[model samples]
Each structure stands twice: as C-alpha cells, then as structure tokens.
Target chain A: MEKEKVKLRIYGMTCDDCVSTVTAGLKKQKGVIDVKVSLKDGTGEVNINNKEVKPEELLRNEVFTRPSHYKAIIIND
Target chain B: MSEPEKFDLVIIGRGAAAFSAAIKASELSNGEMTIAMVGTGPIGGTCVNVGCVPSKYLLEASHSVFKPAHPRMPGLHETEVKYDFSKIMEGLRSYVSHARDSKYVKVIENYSNVKLFTGLGSFLDKKTVVITGPDGKEVGKVSGSNILIATGSHPSIPNIKGLSNTGFITSDTIWEMNELPESVAIIGGGAIGLEIGQALLHFGSKVIVIEAMDSILPQTEGEIREALKKELESEGMRFYLRARVSAVSRSGNWKSLDVITHKGNEKITVKEIIVATGRQPNTEYLNLERVDVKTDPRGLIITSDTMKTSASGIYAAGDCVSKNMFLETLAAREGVVAVSNIFGENIKIDYNSTTWAVFTNPQVAGVGMTEREFSKMNGSCSTRTFSLLNLTKASITGETEGLIKIVVDPKDNRIVGMQILAPNATDIITEGAYAVRNGYTIDDVISTSHIFPSFSEGVKLAAQSFIRDISKMACCVE
Candidate 1:
C-alpha cells in the first residue's frame, strides 16, 4: 500500500486546544501514523499507512458544533 | 545533543475548550504532564473574543434601548433613543480583551503543566506543532505524543460573484467598522446574520435580511419563526425570504445588490453588505489530505461520536466537524468530550442534548426535536403552544409577540422538542433543553415550579396543555 500524508484545512479553531482536539481525534484512528495540527490557518496534517481510510468514515464519526464547517482533503500521496 | 522535551499533551486553541482541557489533562497527570498551547487570537477563543461575549453585550445594550421604547409600555419616558456604535463596540472590544487576558491567558499561564505559545501553530507532524509569532518569526515547536485540535471555526464567505470586490463584510469583519451603515443588506438569516442584523437595526441601520429559505430560523418551529419574523418586521427590518442574491457591485462608496426575488429581479442599493450566509469550517489551509482526514462537501471535517477523525491519533472538535447549530456552548461541550476521551475516558457526544438559539428581537430558540423534526420522525406526534401575550411578563416587558411551541411524542409523552420566540428566549430555553434532552415528559414540566406571571410560565402552560387529554383541549377556556 502507498503511504499518504493528508492535509486538512480546519475551520472553527480558536486556540491551541482546537489543534490538540483534532490531533487527538485523528491519532485514535487505526491506520494513522502521524498527526500535525496548525492553529494559525486552521489546518491539520495527517499521515496514514493504508488505503482503509475514507472521507465518509471520518465525516460519520466526528462531533462538531456544525459539521459543515470543516473539510479534509488529500494534498499529497 | 540535548534531549528533546517530551510533553504529555499539546492543545492548539485558547478558548474555554482548550483551557478546560488543559486543566483536565493537568489533573489527570501525575504532576509531570507537559501541555503546550498555540493560538492566534486573544487568549479566549470565539466565545470571549468575536463571538458570544461581544455579540451578547451589543445585543443587550441595544435591547435595553429598544425595550423601553416599545408602544405597549404603560408609561413612555421622553428619553431619546440612540446608540453610539463606536462606544458600544469599544466597550465590547475592551471586554473581550479583558476576558482573554484575565480569564483565558491568566488561567493558561498559571497552569504549571501548560506552555503557552502566543502565535500561529502549524503542524510539522502529528506529534509536532510549529509556532510562528505575529511578526512571522518562528518561535519553536512543541512535539507531543497526543495533539488536540481545538481550533474553532470562522464565518463562511460564500462564492457569490463580486462579493469580495463589493467589500462586503462578514460577522467577524464587521466588528472593526467604526461606523454602522445606515442601510445594509444581510445575506443569510442564520444566527450570526440575524444577531448582528438585529443589533445593527437597533443601532439605527435599515437592516434587510435576505434568506434563501422560505423562513428565518430554518431549523426552528414554524410558529416561533413566524412570530420572530413579525416582530423584526414591525421593528423596521425587512425580510426577503426565498431570495437569491446573484451579483454584488460597488460604485464608489455605494453598493448595488442584484437579487432574484420570488416575484422577479430586484436591485437593492445599500451602504454596506454583510454576507452572513453561515460559516464554513476553516479547512482550506490545514492540509487535511496529508493526514487522510475526510470532509463533507461543505468542508466539515468528519469525526465520530468520540470526536475522533479517520486517521489514528487525530481529533477534531468545535465547528470544524460536521454538525449543526454551530454554537459556542455546543463547541465548548464537544471540546470537553473530545479531550476527555483522548485522555482515556470513553464518552460519546450527545447531540440530542444540545440547545440552539438565534439572538434576535423576540429571540428564537429550539432544543431536542423541533415540531418539524418530530413530525418527520413519527407522523403521530402532537404539538401544543402557549402565546406570550397570555403571560404577564410579556405584558410587563412589553414584548408579547412570540410563543412557546412544544412537540410531544404521543405514545410515551416524551418532550421531543421545544421552541420559543420571546425576549430572553435564549436564556429561557435552557431549562426546556434540559428537559427535552433528558426525555422528560410534558407532565414533568407542568409539575415543576415556575414563578407566577413569568414568561417562563408559557413553557409550563404549553407542557400542561400537552399533558391534558384531548377532550379538555377541544373544550378549553376561551
């Protein structure tokens, strides 16, 4: 399986805890290897080792104030 | 080589959620947990900075000005009504600063396990976050085994043509303007738009709200929305429901907005335009693809009931994930849940327990299932409502325009939803949300103690009505 690092442009983050919240959430995933969160521009970077991750799986799992505000996209592979 | 400093946790937001999480993490550790915080805004996040705190102050100030001026009051004072936008904004700004400094920063800095980084934090990896100072200088990186993303959301600017060129401002941007526009068009009738719109209306703006939906407060009950619409319209604000704005143009200092109205094409000229079309998750930059996190079409980061995203060791909270009623209270709640779960506590978020309110004249609020939602879920549920005009407090406050609507599940008498349209509706709905969230029966509400002649009695009345037999409802007192 190809190794992929994904970047998530996060919105609705207010402080360092926001970055930590997302980082801690992603770190719980089974295939996730690394998680980086940026509070400056409201973005998160994550590393995965398998093809098991799907966007729907993530969307179905998170609790947000309004789920529509945040998005995760693959910037590289 | 010096050994790297190993921290137990790193949080990236400074709001109630971040600080609270830090406090909790500190307590959980054996006096050895190292927590790092990176935030760009003032110490407090949205709730204290640009969101609830400041907005509510402005709302209260304006409400005080308007409440005494209503026609229904017994005796009218010959006092002139006016709002100095700058002064009100100044006070709010000062309050926000104090809240951030005294409440947020002081707490974080005082925590022995926490390291505060007053800058923008970017992810070097899942375990490392690089902090950049306001001057664009690299401060340092804090690498933690567990990273929490509490970065809150911001206002979502739509993709309307020429919107940016027209110099339209969002809720976050409007706070800085020294002068309020005499005439302004607020697009999107959601909480932010409506709250700011009502504030501006009281502040002397001829506010016009253009909503894409058929009614304002879309998620609320129809009756409450209707009541709010009537009250706001009576207060001199205009509503253009089912209106779609196609283009915006600016000529010199004035602006022209082209809207596709239900009747036909219309052009509105206003001094300013506020696009409150709702907020998008601040995900465009966070390089989620690097971590393989998935988002919905609207850019909401996908997370689970546990606030965990797709990738391992990552978590998302606040408005960044897919959820509705993007409120500060909800965000704070989710923030606590996300962090606690990360520290090995197994807890799931309870969406049904969340309460939402739109700060408007005769404020609108809803909790649990709205009548619409309940009816959609089970076709047999019934509704009962109590008008504020029937309540003595409304007469005293002279705000008798809205009502309380309760949706009850007929089979088990569960209070599924409650909606309110009245002054202090946001504050009043908290009790109702607690009831509904706990699946309290309407009988419980009716049996509870309520102050005599209070607007909250309306809730008790509606609950009583729902608990009564159908024969009594059909032959009730006139």
Candidate 2:
C-alpha cells in the first residue's frame, strides 16, 4: 500500500507553461496523489496510489498523445 | 435486403445508464460483444446536458455576485457584483460541453465494441429497435438479443390551461435563457423549483415560488422543509403555498398567471415562467407495449429490483424505472444492475439506501427512511433532531439555518434514516446512507470520528443525542 513514484522525461517543453500542462495532466491521472513537474529538467515526478495505478501506465496517458507532440517516457536509473 | 444490423445489446440511451451498461457489457464479454447505443438530443443525458452541470455552475457563479452584495457577516462591506449575464450563460454552456465530452463521451471510448447511434430509438418488437431521425424518416434498424431501456426522463409540464401556448421554461429549456428576466414565477416548490428560483433570486430577479402542496419540499422531512422555507424567505424569496396555476396568458411584454392561492385567487405577472412541477420518464415514443413492458400510472417503466422489465431480454433502468428520485449516480447504478441481470446475475437495487440531495444554499440531503416511513413500516421508532445553531461549525461560519434529524428503530437501536438541512448537507449525508444501508447502530456512528469544526460533525452529534444531552457536551469531546 506504499505510495509509488515515477520519473518521466517529458518532451515538447519550451517554457513554464509546458510544466503546468504536464502537471495538470499528471494530476488528472487515476490514483495520482501528488505531482511535481520541473521545467528546468523537463521531468515529471508523480506520486500515485499503487493499488489503483502502476508506474508504467503514466507513459500511456492521453496527456502525452493528445497534442500529438507532447510526449513522456519513463526515466530509468 | 440480406439482413438488418445486429448487436449483442441495443441500448436506448446515451446518458449515464447506457454508458454504464456499455462499460459493464464490455467487462462481462471481454470486449467481444457488440453494442449499439441510440439516443436523442444531447449525448450526456439530463444531468450534464441540462440539469445538474449548468444549474449548479450558475448557482455557484452567481454566488460570487450575489454573496458580495448581500454580505452575511456584519463587519463586511456590502459590495455590488456586476457581470454580463449572457457571458455567464455562455461560460456555463462551455463548461457543460467540456464536462459532457470528458465525463460521458470519453468514458465509453475505451469500449470499442459499443457503437454510438444518433437518433430516437423505438422498439419495433421485443428484440428489434428502429432509429428515427429528427426529420421523422427511418434512419436505421438494429436487433439485439438483449436491449436496455435506459431512456431517462424529461421535465414534466403541468396541465394548466395555455401553459404550453403561452410559453414556459423547464429545467431542460432554461439553459437557452441568455438574458435575466425582470421577474419570474417558478411553479412546483420542489427541489428543481427552489434551487433555480433561489439562484435567479440571488441574481436580483423578482422571484415568486408557487407550490401546490402545503409546504415547499413536500417529500422531504417536515422539519427540513420548514427550515428551508424559513431560510429562503429570509433571503427575500416569495412563496405561494397550497397554490395552483389555473392558467397562463401572455400579454404585451409580460405574462400573467391566474393562481389559486390558499388566501384567494390572484393574478400574478412576470417576465418569465418556469415550470418545475417534476419530471416524467422519457418513454412516450418507446412503444413499450409492443414488448409487453409494464408501466406505472405515472408512466414510469416498471422494473424489478434487479432492473429486469416484464418482457424477457429487455431491461430498464435510471429515471425510467426510478419511483421517486432521479439522479445521475442512481441511473448509472441501475444501468449496471440491468446489464448484470442481462448477463445472468441477480444484483438488486436497495432503494432504502439511496442517498440524494437538493442543491439550494444550505443544501438538503437524506438517506434511508424518514420517521414517518419507518413508523408506518415497523410501527415504532425513536428519533433525534440536532439543530445547526449548536454545531460549532455552523456557529463559527455564521450559517446556522438548518438541522439534522436521525431516525432509529427502537427494537434494534439501528439508525433507520438521516435527513440533513445545512451547508454541505449533500456531502455529509453519505455517512448516514452508509450507516442505514449496513444497519449500523447509533453507537457505531458515534464511535467513528468526524473532522472537528466541520459540518459533517453534525451527524456524529445527532447520533450522540440518543445517549446524552449533546447541547451541554463540550466541543471535540469523545
């Protein structure tokens, strides 16, 4: 039942606006408890309720595909 | 022709019920079965399309305007709020569109087997349905082994003379109103009437509510109804009780209503008339008789607790089958039940546990049986009423105009029902509903802790009333 964390390298970022867009997207995901999107690193750190969601599902979220340019890939290591 | 289009299930609605059934059917069949969903009007049913979304949005939006001008706190300066009413209406429409696309339209996109058909679906026979376009031409035909009659309800216009010809707005058509009327006469005095009437009154409209019953919210707990009447009256909203609209006639620039109030017959004039008498199930064009589906005298489709119609392979749910309450959540639940029964399971809907709310300021909410219903059903029950004046939250917030009433069966000490009339009562009633649904005792309710200084704390205090005089109890006492 522990909270799970996922780090993603988000694309199509040019300004703080992209971070906000990604943050809103991550927050809307199921089981998402907390979301922190860094404009500098272009990374989205998400805390999720593990029972209802898995880390891999974040890569498949519509937020990445809707604009057809914004993308996210799970960061390894 | 070789053959007509065939589906595993043909759902007769695009709203909550049909959407819910489509999801359940997908789950049951593992995305293997075909589903044909036919609908009329908007895609998201009454709630998002016309009823809850736009109505509640305006209520809260206008609150920003109305509350500042009519300041509750004594020290606060009365500041006038101004805005273009048409722009606000436009904003409401946009919000409704976003909500519908997200909540209703996109929810079903995951199920590829479920197909959407835009038309009015009518039963050709028990197994077949024909879709008709707005032009009154036959659009298409589809037959399913199983059909779900999830067609919900529409606003009911009363039989008053010239009501239709003279023109009036119901919940369904009120969204089209761009300009705020100078004054309005709202009929029914029910949840729909009071909620919208209060919102318009907040927006500086001269609002008069006419109720055929002796009191507003006649179906709610008596004390809750009385408290609501008092609260609304204090806000300068007018009421005409034990009244009926005899006729409606439109004159130059205004309309006149011949109303038979308890005192005497009075002719009232208003710029707009809103009929909120109630809603009737959307079954008129369904041709249910062809399928041997039975309906109550009120024209609601009759279905078993399991959501099965009298006819085999046909099931009904939502406002079409609901006896008293018409809610989106209830409709979705009934849809699930119908789909489950169709797929061979016996899941019954427990009406006793159904929780609903009226979204007037100082909202009204209830779950389970009232003292009147409990006493009549079981012959005896104990009760307690906890006033908002005593609740620390209500006192601190300066919104002490409501009460919570809990009904307990004397024999078992189990809480049979709970009714609340207070700020955020709608959200708080869920706890009461959970208790009544599972036969939780008064002690159980008291054992669980509620957040202090919160409106929901009233539920705990009401439960505590059975054991001791909660009026003298210290705040935050265990």
Candidate 3:
C-alpha cells in the first residue's frame, strides 16, 4: 500500500482532554497508521497507507467545531 | 451470504437526543432486539458534558461567591474573596463524571436488549454503521433496519481579520482554563455569550459585550430585554450595541479591538476575547450526497416535520438537522418523534410550542410566540402584560423590575404565548408552555388559582388583563 501524510486543522481542542478526544477519533479511521495532534496550533498530522483514501471521505467521519475552526489540508508527498 | 451482524436499530450519538431515543427504542422492542451506539466525548453528550450542565453549575457557584458578603453590603465595600479555579473545575468535572457513571450507565445496564459501543460511528451505507475504537482499530461494522443521526453542534467563530494572530478563545474552550481572566471582551450578545458574560462579570472581570445588533437578546420581549439590560448595566458591563468589529491584534500583553461605531472607528483593549456568535450543525460527515440526503450550503441536514431527511430509510434529528429548535429539551423531543415514526408510529414535532431561556441576571424565559413573532404571523392576536411592581412577591424579593406578558387570539380566547422576566423565569415559563401546547385559552390561565404570594401569580394577572369584564370579579381579583 502507498502511504501519504495529511494535516487536519481542528478547533475546540482547548485542553489536553480535547487533544485526547481528537487523537482517539482520528486513530479509529480504517487506514490511519500514526497520528500526532497539537492543542496550540489546532492541527493533526496523520500517516495513511490507504491509496484509495480521499479528502471528501475524511471530512465525512467525525464532527469538528465548524468549517472555520477546523479544516483538513492534504500535504504533497 | 456470511452471517449478518444483527441488530434492530443503531444510533450515532450519546447526548440527550440519542439516549432518549435509545430508551424509547429499547422499550418498543419488548427486550428482544439488539442495539448499539457510540460517543466521541465523555459518555454523556453536550448538555451533560459541557454546554449547559457544567456552565450552569459554575454560574451558580460564581453567583454565590459574588453575592454580598455581609447581610446587607450595598453600594461598594472593600472585601477579599478568592477562588481556587483548579479546585472548582475539578469539582465540576467530578460532578459531570458522577452523573454519567451513576445515572447514564445504570439506564443501559438495566435494559436487556441495549448495548453500548464507545467509539466513532460512520455510515457505510444507509443500513450499515462502522464503529472505530480508540486504538486505531475497526471494532465492528453492523447493519440495522433503521439509523438515527443525533450528533449535535459545536461553537462557530466568525472570520475576523487578524484574529488568528491575536489569539482568541470560544465558549467551548473557556472551561479548560484554570485561571480567571482579569478582563474580557465578548464578541457576541447571544444566549451563550450573555450567559458566560454574566458569569465572568460576577467572577470579577470587567466584561464588555459587543453586539452587531442594536440590543442584546434581540428576539426576546422588549420589557425583559430592557430590565435585563438595566441590571447588567448596574453590574458595570459595557455594551457596544450596533458595533461591528473590524480587526483584532495583539500589542504587548493585551488584545486590541478595532470597532466601527455610529460615530466612526474606535479601539478597545482587553486581556482576552471570546467569540460566542453561535453554533453550526454537525453534518460534515455521512456522505450525504451518496444517499441523496439534501442539506443547505452550510451543511445543515433538511428534514420534514416527521424528522425524515430527503433520503429513504434515513432519519436526522438534533442540531444536525435544519428544523432544529436548538435546546436539549427540544432535541430530546425530536428524537422521540423521529424514532416513533421510524418504528411505524406517526407523530410530528410541534415546533410552535418550544420554550427558550437565557440565564442572565433576572433571567429571560419565553414560550410560544413573542409579540414580534406574533406580529410577523399577523394572526389577529392581541398582547397584555402585568408588571412585577404589582405583585407582592416581587416587592418581598426586591425584584420589581420584571414583568409577564400573555398573548391571546381574541377570535377564540386561546392563549398563543407567554413571556416572563423574573427570578424563576425558567421554572415559571413551563406552565405557560404547557398552556400553549395543550390549547389552553386565556380564560383557563386566568381562572386557574395560584398559591398566595407566588411568582406564577403574574401569569394569572396578565391573563386577566386580556379580558374586559373586571368589575364582575371578586375583590383583589383584578
């Protein structure tokens, strides 16, 4: 399987509690290999090995704060 | 075909809406069906976890702390009152944890057919739900005859210029801090903003509320808003009504707000800023297009009165749906209606009777139509109100600035709505909500006897004012 890295800019991750919640949610996805989330910048870096994974498919998984507070940006290579 | 993972139903949230649906769904199956569910936060949903329960508990504590230290210490007195913010938060968290552990878990434990799943649930299709556990594993994906979406909303911060660099906070994040701010600038004047604004003011912050509208709580009745404004003003709040914020930037240790007022541009500075504008529906997921479910451009799932979305065999409720009234009580009610319809019992949500309350000083509670909503309806309704100054209880409590108003359809004498601004406004408005919901008329409210010197007696007096025949009543009646 080919691997790719993606970044998710999230909101509502105020405390360590929120970080744990978001990290728990992302790790539950089908092909996510490893994840690192930051409470300060409100972003998550995920390593995915599923070549078929798409951005639209990722957006449909969990409830974020809103479109403004959270967004997923895919990184090239 | 491989043996199907079996269940009669599956639910996607763990809030008041989801649990209420679960309770009903379990009973309707006669203890012979399998049910599964999941939650992204703590076991309980928003209201219990963060939105209302914890905030109100903190509000009550802060109100007590801010109350006069002496039996009667008025005007101003120098006194020292310190709060252990971390301890208080720990207590609040423990309270929420105890409620969920003792109350919620027992409900599921006693039910025979109910099962709980702790993870994220996503739609594999209209009939299938895949559960993802906390440790990056697909725990299970099962199919069911019906599914309900009760995942609620989250805070929405406005797209303000320079806000990203300035560093700001929203209501959901406010609870995480153990340190109280010395001063704060609140960006919105809606229910959440005003509620938290009052709490922070009581906790000793020089709070400033900025509203783009001309007044705070714009949709509330005129008299209640005025009285609340007066009380909040007396508490030393600065209201920049009709003020639009242009930009925000950090200079040194403070954040500066660039606002445009009627006169022109002005700047205000504060230690911190909170964006409490409002919330957005949690419908970014479910691949709505794949199932033909329709949503607005903003992604609010559109549903009918029966709570059925545009797709077949799919239902939506709570904050995720567009027809949402946006209260925990309303969400729970909608959940029951949606499940009943899904199970072949037909019932539609009656949006007309929903009640709302804002926990400001003197508080604001409203049910059914307001004069504004009534005027917009143009349904031949007339309004009459009674002042708290006329009530003995108000005089005793020294809260004479509040009032109660009732609106009636003169053609049929039916009570259409009621509004109250009083000490127990939330508790009192439920009776009015019951009146409007059950088709009670003005005569019914007026003739209903209330205990002497009670808060709810205002409802009877307001109802009496709607009729013309007062002379025929007994003494002290009108």
Candidate 4:
C-alpha cells in the first residue's frame, strides 16, 4: 500500500533473472510496496510508502554490487 | 504343472502404479518381459474404481446443479435442479466403468506378456509373491526377477465408541448407494471429505463436515483453506472444526453422532455418515516382514529416492507408500520412476514441483514450497498475495471468489512456491509447477504471455504484484 513512485537506472544486469533479483531486493526494503525492473532498459520503477526512505537509499542497497552484479542510481526525471 | 510361473516382473497391485510400472517394464524389455499383475480390488485400483474418477464425475454433476441454483451472474435467474440420486450415480458408475476399460484394462491388454491375477498378493519371499483367493485357498504364485508393491491404501477410520458397530460408509463404498440420503455428516474435513460433502450438498443433502483440526484441508495454505471454508459455508455447508465424533448410535434408518468440541457436546442425527479421517497404506497384508521389506511406524513402505524398497529387487509406489501419496497421476509417475530406475535410468521424482488440486466449486491447487516453508528454509523470504477481485476473467465470468499467492526466494526472486483458490485453480497451477520446477523467476512467469482475459492470468497478475500495484495499473500493462 505505497504511493510514492521512484525510478532508478540499473547497471550490470546480464539476464532476465537479474531483473527479478533487483526487484526482490528493492521490494524487501521496508517502505517499498511495488517494484518493476527491466533488464531491457536498465531502469526500474518503484513505489514507496514511507517518505523517510529516499531513492538514494536504494542506490547503495547491498542487494546490488555485491554477491549480485547490479548497481542503481537515482533518476531525477 | 508343478513349476511356479516365472515372470520378469511381478506387480502387487493393478492400479495406476502397477499398470504404469508394467508398461514401463515392458517398454524397457522391448515388449519381451513377462509381468504378473496381482490385485485384490478392481483392475484399475482405487482411482477409476472408487477414487478420482467417480469423485470428479460427481463433482461435475453436482456443480452443474450448484451453478444454476446459485446463479452468480446478474442476468441469470436462479433455477431449480431436480436430480434423481440413483440416475446421477448410475451415470458416474458408467463413466468409471468406461475409464477403467479405456485407461487400465485395455492398456494392459496391449502388453501380451502381462498376466492379470485377481487375489491377495503377499510375499512368499523377497523374489516371489503368493496369491491367495478370498476363499482362503492358494490361487497362484508369481516368482519374478524384480517386484513392485503398488497396493495403494484403504480408508483409516478413527476409533470412536459405537462408530464401527453403528455402521457407516467410506469414500470407496459410497459409490454403491442407491439413493442420496436426506442428510449426511462426514467426519474429517480433508479434500475427499469436503469434495463429497459439497457435491452432496448441491444434490440437496444436508451436509455437515467435522474436522479435528481447526481448519479443513490441513495441508493447504491458511488463506486458501479459509477462502474455501467461506465459500462452502455460504453455500449452506456446515463445518464443525476443532471437533471430534465421540460416539455413535443407530435408530431405525437414522444414525446419530455425539460430536465433542471444546465448547460442548452435541448429538446430531443423519441418514448417512462418511468416515474420511485419512488413509493408511495397504502393507498390512503384504507380509512385508517375511521378505525383510521394512515399513515405517505407520505401515508405509519405506523407499529410497530411487523408488527402491529396503529389500533389494523390490519397489513400492502410490498411496501404499509415504512419498507419492494419493494422486493417481503422481502414483503413476512414481511407478514409472520405480520401473525406470529398475531398468537403470537412475531417475528420481522431484515432489517439490509436483502439483495437486481439490474439485470444489472454487477449486484449490498448489505446487512447491509454501510461504512458511520458504521462510523456514531461508531465514526470511518475500511473499506476495493477489486477489482475484482485480482479475478481468473473474469479473467477466462473475465468479470472483479467489486468491493467488507466490512465495519467493529473496536472493534470486525465483518462484519457489505457488497456491491458488479459484474456479480453475487446478488447471492454472500447472504453469506454476513448471515455473517452480524449472527455476523460473517471477519475471519469467510475467514474460510468458498468458492468454488475455483467462483464469490463468491470475498467476501472471500474482507475479506482477511482485512489481506493479495491479489495482491502479491498466489492463495487461507490462
């Protein structure tokens, strides 16, 4: 039940499985209600319920750039 | 005349498992293998004879009446369905006969090397099975290079005072009823119990379901079970969860049961009673100890992943065993696996990806790990639930009582588990089985492009809920 939508450009996703990994990781975060990651576009659209949680927090989330080879950066637009 | 019949394989049941094993063995031997199929019951086993075939036919027939009397569509008016119980059961019996002939009897006829023997097959030795007739005489003997014990199972009636002597029927013998009872109370809220209960309700019988557990279908997910309970309750099916039948009494044509629950005890009388507590394997008469074949504490034959029993040269599958369970298809698969492993295929069945269903109006089906299971395996896991309220298919059909849920492994977001409660959840769960079995992620389910405006879309939408807020999204948005 989140309403705030955010977009983030992703890096290092090689297969469709990576899309799911990123989606799950982002959705696992406490305020996130919805997440859609596209390996085709290297971008993800996300919905967050908490105003305290920012897009910048998702960028450095451990789900990306560790055991998994994915990275994210805030898309201001 | 003094020589015992020597066969390449001996199967101790003629049900799905035995027939499948025979076919596989024959195929492996290039139709040259001689097989002895020994059975105590009908040739097709419990399924076509007393289980799935008749049960499903009854479900469909009852649903036909149920749909019209309780019309969901606004444009459709409620219609009365006056059905003759005997005639409806006669048709079901006819269908069962046809299925037995087509699926089992004829299939066996194609295997010229297979000989069907009707008797109680018990172990004469590890390699030989002795067939005894019901008249307490030695009917035949089968000595084989290898043996399969697919003897299936029998209904396990709970030990309540006066219950046995009070007289009742099981799912098996219920097919023999000449008339549907005016009222019936079924003990045990398992799948078969509810199935028969609901079908009888639609046929105008006052149905009562009593379960020792707090909920029916104890193995099913909580949401799915509760949803079904609600639907069935709405349809006038009464439930007595957290209850046990303490005593029984027979008065003329009616039977009365003393039902004990935490609250209090109540005596209810009905025309008939169905004991559907559960099932136990048919290893009791197998004389497994004579052959050193070990059964578990509960009498289920123990087998390895390869479907090989503790005793070498012997295998077991189907309801008689603990692993494969009561589904006719799974039993057949286990039989094939046992036969294939005997032929050195080294095949093992993955039960995690296996699927099963109930035939109630809004059917329930599931595959792989449940949400709790996934959480237990992984310290924590993500789970998503989708309501059929948003489904176009449900909206169009005007039958919108359903829920679809997916359990995900957070690390990879793979669809580790799926369960559904819907009109066609049984059919839709196949895609979930394939996805879980093949390690397909939720995106894989979404990318598969399910047919638009179909019940199957519930699965895709469930997957989409992992990403999109479906309530606000446009129809079929990526």
Show what share of the native A-B interface contacts model 3 retains.
0.00
- Predicted candidate 2, C-alpha RMSD: 13.6
Candidate 3 lDDT over B144-221, as tens digits, reads 666778888888878889998998888677777677788899999888888888888888889999999999988788
Query: What is every candidate's C-alpha DockQ against the true complex, given to 2 decimals?
Result: 0.03, 0.01, 0.01, 0.01
For A43-73, candidate 1 gives per-residue lDDT tens digits of 5676777687753244333522234333332
Residues forming the 10-long window of minimal summed lDDT in candidate 4 chain B: B25-34
Question: Sorted by lDDT, highest first, which candidate order results?
Answer: 2, 4, 3, 1
Clash totals for all candidate models? 93, 0, 1, 0
State which candidate has the highest DockQ: 1
Runs with alpha carbons beyond 4 Å of true place in candidate 2: A1-77
Candidate 1 wrong stretches, greater than 4 Å = A1-77, B1-5, B132-139, B467-478
* Candidate 4 lDDT over residue span B3-28, tens digit each: 45877678999888898888977765
Each candidate structure's TM-score, on Cα atoms with residue i matched to residue i, is 0.81, 0.85, 0.80, 0.85
lDDT of 2 at B331: 92
- lDDT: which is higher, 3 or 4? 4
| Candidate 1 per-residue C-alpha lDDT over B1-478 given as tens digits, one digit per residue, 9 for 90 to 100 | 2233445567777776677777766654433356787787767777787888878888888777766565566677645577677888888888778877888777766677687878777666666677778787777777765666777778877778999888988778776877878899999987888898898887778999999999887787777778788878888989999999999999888999999999999999999999888777666656677767778998887889988888766777777778876777777777777766664456798888688888777788888887777777788788888887667678687777888888888898888888888878888888777887788988788678887777777788777766454334431222
Q: Is candidate 1 or candidate 2 better by lDDT?
A: 2
Better of 1 and 4 by TM-score: 4
* Model 1 chain B weakest 10-residue run by lDDT: B469-478
